[model samples]
Target: MSFASLGLNQTLLDAVAEQGYNAPTPIQTEAIPAILEGLDVMAGAQTGTGKTAAFALPILQFLSAQTRDSSGKISVRALILTPTRELAQQVHASVVKYGAQTDLRAALVYGGASINTQIESLKAGVDIVVATPGRLIDLMYKRAVDLSQVEYMVFDEADRMLDMGFMDEIQRILKVLPSTRQTLLFSATFDDEIFKLSKALLKTPKLIEVDARNTASIQVEQRVYAVDEDRKRELISYLIGSQNWQQVLIFTRTKLGADALAKEMCKDGLKTQAIHGDKSQGARERALEEFREGKTRVLVATDLAARGLDIEELKYVVNYELPFKAEDYIHRIGRTGRAGGTGLAISLVCEDENYLLQEVETKLETQLPQQWLPGFEPDLTREVKKAPRRNSRGAQKQRARERALGKKPTKRRR
Candidate 1:
């Protein structure tokens, strides 16, 4: 349905329309109404699903309808906690954009910036505060900000926060917040840990899931290349140059690898930059800005910078190194194929990562077609065997019985 039918204020609707959003996305369609109803919500939707606007719009509406404090001091009524500085800034931007015509004031506070400036902004007062967990906790410890009156709280990218090891900080923050406030938890995927945390944090929450796990976006065309470990960089360079690809994202496993790859690509006359946690905030922001503006042809990033990266028309994603966890493979490729747009995801697999690839294929419930470069075919005589699959107790007993009966045991394909 059209965003106009979502009961958004005319000014907010105008803002959305100006942004060229004619219809609500699935996550937005389900989340906006539940949020407006003041119910706790837990949403499972991938990045680039307009999840930010889902909660941002409703929070803006709620804050606008409230009466200002008698002292004319704008105490924060809503707190949005995000995992990364980039995601925090993005959510803050949406809040400001949608609340531009209203009386609400929003501010973004995160690390890698001067705490003095954030403290000054807190003193000036704000209606909504978007922050990272660490910096928010620091501010609260110094009594620089108060959340006792916070009416709404949001944990955007909840799984990412958990991955970053912010569980203690999250619990501490929750302890300080008012128990009567409305809560919302939005994540790309749900695991046992996230489910347990949701049970503790939400009160009979409305559940919204737009896609099932193990389902990658259909808009993405995925391919895998079997290459030697040493030839991966050469193959990547050749592919980009041969295809004249612009705006490609390359993922590496470590910060050093990301930096080295970007440097080598630059040496090959391609504009490139590396973004990771080690880089200063300004450097990271500049790199992202250049990449978004199409000034940089390639951006090499580690896993930390990979999550919550929203780049429009991102044509290609290359997995320079496969993650150890199979689930992360899904997230890596998900950087592309955004917003129902066609994209490509390419993975470079070496001998060492063969088992990782098999695990990933099993998790996806589909076998990936492996392609060999004309001159890069691996040696079949090497006999590289993966570790044997683990068997359950019942399966082991059945296998023993078949062996005793002189019958071959059947293999169960994952």
Candidate 2:
């Protein structure tokens, strides 16, 4: 349906149209109206579902249409909390874009940046504050920002925030907000934790589910490659080079793994960068910018990037290592195949990660196609007495061929 029909005024309509989205997405259509009515809402919307605009548009309209005090500095009227700084930035950007026609101001609050700058912006006045939980808490401790005047609260990626262990912080934030505020919770999946959160925070909220819960993007082509743990790096390199893949986003389980993999790929003559929590905000942003601009062929990242890091037309996503949670698999693959574009997601599964693969399949309720790459098949006995086993097996049947070629067969130690 058109955004205008969803109760948006001409200003918001023009802003969305400028963004080239004449039609409201399913989540937006359902959410904008309810939010305008000042009702609590619990929504299930996956990545790339225009979930940001669903909440941002209505909230911006609400703030702009009202006549609040314009003389004094504006306190925060809306607080949108995201799990990570990247997602907070994503949500804030949407707010800025949609509210371009209004006089309302928004501030971004997150760690890794100067709190002094954020405090100054908050002091100047802001109608909306999009932030991460920890950084927002820090501001609260310093009394840099006031939330007592907040009338609207949104928990973007609610499931992820809980998964990242922000429930206590959320409770603390909730304690400061006005009890009469409208609450909205948006999540990609609805688990027990989210259910409890909604029950505790929402008041007779309208429940909306736009897509199947815990499902990956349907536009992605997913495949699994069975390779030896030691050969996973090799297989990924070969696949990218042999298939002429570009803009590949690779996910590793650990920060060190992401860094090492990126370094090795760079040594292999591939343009690569790594991003994780340890990297400074500037460094992380630079790496992302370079990758998006095609200056980098590959971006190796930990699970922290699975929820954020939006890249338009990203064609390839590689799971160098599977995540502990099956739900994370969905998020990692969701990085590709966004905004109605098709993409390919490949997982490199060795013997140790077979269980992780099984968990993913169980979560998806369908087994992914498993195949072995040429010359990089799973060597199951590689961890055992491999040298002697190879020699006993005539060094993989090549020793007999070597002796046939008149090459000396070296004596074995007794």
Candidate 3:
């Protein structure tokens, strides 16, 4: 259905049309109506599903209908909490963009920036506030902002916030918000913890699951390459150089790994940038801008920056390092194949990551096809060795010796 049929204001609808969104996505179609009805909503949607617009559009419409008191200043009526600074900035941008034609004013507050600017924004009075939990709490403790009048509350990326250990901060923020406000929780996956938290926050909520859990987008072509750990960087360079991929998103396990890989790729003549939590907010934004604007051929990042990355038509995603959790595989590959656009996801699997690959296959309920590149095929002459029994003292002694020699110690047989 069209966004106009969702009961959005004419101006808001015009704004959405200007943004090139004429029809609502499945998630948006279900969520906007429920949110406008003042019902708590629990939505399960992956990145690039236009989930931000799902809530942002209705929020602007709802706020535009209300009449503020005199002084042209109103108490914060909505608070949107996100897990990371990037996501907060993204959601805040959506708010500003969608609410451009309305009387509503919105502001974003997060760490790694000047609190004085945030304090000034709050003091000026805004209709909606998007913030990270840490900085939100800081403002609350200082009495710089009041949430007693907040009627709508949104927890964007609820699962990520919990993963980053923001449960206590979320609980604290909840305590201060009005008890009668409408609560909405949006996430990529629904784990047991998400359900438990939902039960506590929602009141007979409208549950919307637009896609199956653990399912990657059908627009993505998935493949795996078996290579040694030391050769992964070279393999990536070869793939990018030979294939001439214009914009590629590479995922690494750590910030350090991301930085090093970006540097190496740059040395290989592919313009590259790294983004992670350790980088300054400005630096992270600049790197993402460069990648999005086609100025950089590759963007390496950790999993934390994987979510909320809304690049359109990203050609490829290279998994340089597999995540420890199998579910993260879905999120990583999701960086490509967005918005019904065809894309590719390639994983560089080392022999040591066999177990991780198996776990991922089990989660996806399908075996990822393995392809051998020319001159990059794994050596079949090498035998896969089994770990020795730990019960034998000789085996333990051998393992100790291998560890002392800077080798991977053999796993103890179960």
Candidate 4:
């Protein structure tokens, strides 16, 4: 169906046409109507699926229907929380573009920038605020923003936004929002934590899912290579050199690993860059820009650092090292195949990481096809893990909780 059929007004439809979007994605098709009807929605879709507009349009429509708050001013009526500054900026930009035809005001707040400027912007009283949790908390403490009038709340990346790291901050924010407000939770992937948070936050919410849970995009060609952990860097450089891939995104597990791998790739005569939390925001943005512009052939990054990274036409993603979490495998590989584009995802699995691979397989409920590259054969004499996978937090917690009850916990996947 068209955007017009999704309960959007003529102005938004005109905006959509101007943006050159002919129709809504699956998530949008299902979510916009329910959200406009004032229903709490929990939506799951992969990256680059136009998730921003799914909730943004409905939010704008709801706000446009009412121009002012009880104080006869444009107070903060909607709040969109994201995990990274890049994503917050990206979402805010989309909001401005969609709401351009209307008079709705929007503000952005995140760390690593001058809070005074954001404070000044909030002084004008915006209708919507797209912010990262930490900086929003800073604004809250400084009394630079007000959220008591917030009627619509959105968690853009629920997986990372409500994880153990940000849960405390989320709790602080949730305590301030109106309890009767409509909440929208969107995530690329889901786990036990997401489910628990949804239950605690949403009230009889409409569940919207595009594909099967924990599944990657079908447009992507997935493959796994068995090589020695020590020679993974060599294999990666050889693949890029032999295949002549100019734009490839690599995933590492830590900041140090990303930096070291980037250095080695640069030494191999391949232009490379590394981005992670340890680097300044300016450095991270510069690295991303250079990589996107094809000045760098490879970019190594950790999982957290890669959130909200929007790269159009990216065709290759390499897991230089497996992540400890299985859901992260899906997120990392998701960087390549986006917006219905065809791409390739390669995972370098050594013997030590077979357990992690098994965890991913369990999460997907299917085994990834494995093959060996020429001259990079691994020693097949060693046995892979025969035990049930238990690397995820849910499994660990279940084991502990069961032990307390004098019972054995069944093995579970992420």
Candidate 5:
């Protein structure tokens, strides 16, 4: 149905029309009515199903309908918490775009940016604040942000927030918000944790899911190529060049892998960049901008770094390395096939990562069709060799414990 049929005001309808969306997506169709009716909602839709607009529009409408004092001071009326800086910025952009026709004000707060600037923005009085947990908590501690006035609360990508270890922060945030406020939770996937959080956070919420749990987008065509780990870079380069793909988003499990893959692709004469937590926020933004503008032929990124990437026409996403977590596989490939666009997701599966691949496929409930490219087929007789273990957090903690006890660190048992 049209957005107008969803009972949105003319201003919101104008914004929607300007954005070239004639109708509500399934999530929007199910969620908008419930939200406008003052019901708390827990929504689950696969990536790129217009979930943002489902909550954003109603938030704008709900806030705009309220009476305000002539004092012109702003206290946050609504708060949207995202998991990452990129996602926070992405949601803030949507809020601005949809609420442009109204008198509402919005601001974004996240880490890796100037807290001073965010403080100044908050001081100017904003009706809505879209923020990441860490930065928002920092602002709260400094008394620069006031959340007690929040009438509506939203947790975008709730699953991702929990995955990033934001549950404690989320509880802290909830404690500060008005207990009577309406709450909305949106996620691409749901698990026990998300369900438990919803039970605690929402009061008799309406559950809206457009797709089955843990399923990938039907619009995205997924395929896998069985290749040796050493030759994955070569296979990706060959596929991109031979297939004439202009822009591609590639996923790697580690920051080092992302950097190395970008370097390899660039040496092959393709413009490429890597984005991860290790890079400065400025560097990440610049790389994403270049990729969006078609200046970079490839963008290699770790899973956590790619959240909140909203590319309009991205056609290709490659998994150079499978993620340790199955749900991350869904989030990685979701970078493509956004906003009703047809896209392709290719996985370069090596022998060592087969177990990870199996876990992902089991969660997805479908086998990714495997194709072997000429000259890049895996060696049949070779046993799958595991990569050298990196010094992960657990390893680092073990070493720290040994150091504290005045003992030499032993090799990990992995």
Candidate 6:
């Protein structure tokens, strides 16, 4: 249905039209009406489902309807928390674009930027504040921003925030917000932790799931190559070069892996750069920008980019290494096949990562086709040595931690 039917005003409709959106996405269609009715909402929608507009449009309309003080002073009325800087910036841009016709002012705050400027913006007054948890906590400590005045609160990418270990920060932020306020949570998936979080925060919220949770976009063509660990780089290089694939986004499990793979690809004459938490914010943004502009043909990234990096018409994604979590596999390939564009997702599966690949297939509820490229077939004769049998539980736990941290196992201290 059209956004107008969802009870948006002409101004909001005009903004939607400007963006050439005649009909609302499923998430928006379900979420906007419930939000306009003043009900708390917990929505499950993957990336590229127009979720930003679902909340932003309704929020803008709600804020615009509020009575304003004649003194020209602005008090924060809404708080939108995101997981990462890139996602924060993306949500902020959506707010500005959709609220362009309204007088409500919005400011963005996140880490790796000038806090002084953010403080200045908050001091100048903002009706809405979109921020990351860490910077928001810093601003609260400095008394530069106040959530006590918040009438509406939004946790965008809630699952990702919790996955990144922001549970304590979320609780702290919740303690500062008004006890009696509307809350909205949007996430790609809702595991037990997210459900528990919803119970604590939402008051009989309307639950909406736009699609089957944690499933990859159907528009993406997914395939995997079985190769030896040492030959993964060679296979990927050949795929990119032989297929003439432009604008490839590659995901690895660690920062060091991202860096090393980018270097190797560049040595193979492919324009490549790596982005991860270790890179300066400026460098990260520049790397992403260059990749988006085609200055860099490949972007090797760790899980830091699994959710937030948005590139329009990004047609190719490579899982240079699979994530430890099956849920993240969905997010990694989501970078491609966005906004109705056809895309391709390829994974290089070595023997050690076969279990990881199986886990992803289980989550997707379908088997990913294995394609063995000519001249890059795996050396099946090379025997792999299994780790020594120990206490299965303790050994598995240690391996799990190492996989999550993207590190090799370290010996225990005496």
RMSD of each: 7.4, 8.7, 4.1, 5.8, 4.7, 2.5
After superposition, the stretches of candidate 3 with alpha carbons farther than 4 Å from their true spots are 383-414
Q: Evaluated with TM-score, which candidate comes out highest?
A: 6
Q: What is the C-alpha local distance difference test score of each model?
A: 0.86, 0.86, 0.86, 0.88, 0.89, 0.89
Q: Write the per-residue lDDT of candidate 6 for residues 225-340, one digit (tens) a residue.
A: 98887898998999899999999999988887888889999999999999999999999999999999999999999887646888999999999887878889898888888877
Q: What C-alpha lDDT does candidate 6 achieve relative to the native structure? A: 0.89
Worst 10 residues of 6 by lDDT: 388-397
The number of clashing residue pairs in model 4 is 0
Model 4, 52-127: lDDT tens digits are: 9999999999999885647767789999999998899889999999999999999999988899999999998899
Better of 3 and 5 by TM-score: 5
| Least well predicted 10-residue stretch by lDDT in candidate 3 | 396-405
Tens-digit per-residue lDDT, 1-414, candidate 1: 888778888888988987888899999999999999989999998777789999999988888888986878888889999998888988898888888889888889999999989999989989899999999999998999999889999999898898899999999999989999999999887888899989989999999999876557777899999997778888888889989999999988778788888998898888999999999999999999899998999999988886778888898999987776677778778888887788899999877566668778877878898999887776677767454445553554354345323468756457
Give all TM-scores, in the order shown. 0.91, 0.91, 0.92, 0.91, 0.93, 0.95
Total backbone collisions for each predicted model = 0, 0, 0, 0, 1, 0
lDDT of 4: 0.88
Local lDDT at 187 for model 4: 94
- Candidate 1: RMSD to truth: 7.4
What TM-score number comes out for model 2?
Answer: 0.91
Which clashing pairs does model 2 show? none
Predicted candidate 5 versus true structure: per-residue lDDT over 1-414, tens digit per residue: 689899999999999999889888999999999999999999998878899999999999999988887886767999999999999988899899999999999999999999999999998889999999999999999999999899999999999999999988998898898989999999999999899999999999999988998899988999999998789999999999999998899998778778888998999988999999999999999999999999989999988899989988999999987777789999988888888889999999877566667779999998877789989989998965454345364564454345324458767675
